[model samples]
Target: MKPGIRPAHRPVVFRDKAADLASPTRSTMTGDRTVTWEDGTTYPMADVEISSASHPFHTGTARVLDTVGRVERFERRYGRGEAR
Candidate 1:
């Protein structure tokens, strides 16, 4: 590795707004806020809009759209069964 050429990896706190979850991790991102972890160590806090804590996929709250109804509506409007 080149000397002093790579980006610095520092501990940062990633905060999920919706889920109110925060954790410390190594990242190159910078932030103004700071937070202390359970180990009594402080790091720059980065606010994030979404994360696994609040995400629909991880929380099992994902909404499934009904495509069958949409298909029927399209067929009725454009005629799918008849040959054009």
Candidate 2:
């Protein structure tokens, strides 16, 4: 690690509006918004569309999307190609 070469990381708050969650951590990312934590601590706020807290996989809301059916259909349409 080179001194003074790495981007500076400051206290930041990542807010997931959909999940209504806020997390405080250090980051090199910046944002135009500012948010105050419950403890009265203020930090630069970054808005995110999805995070682990709200993502389908993490929240246990993920669906298989009929992958098996799709695969069967594909194989039916394009017979198994001869191994080259």
TM-score of each: 0.85, 0.82
Model 1 per-residue lDDT tens digits across residues 1-84: 779998899999999999999888899999988887898987899999999999999999999999999999999998888668
Instruction: Report the Cα RMSD per candidate.
Output: 2.2, 1.7
lDDT of 1: 0.92
User: Candidate 1, clashing residue pairs?
Assistant: none
- Go through the candidates in order and give each one's C-alpha lDDT: 0.92, 0.92
Give model 1's TM-score versus the native structure. Answer: 0.85
Cα misplacement distance, residue 46 of candidate 2 (Å): 0.4
Q: Across residues 1-84, which tens digit of lDDT does each residue of candidate 2 receive?
A: 778999998999999988999999999999998988889987899999999999999999998799889989999999877988
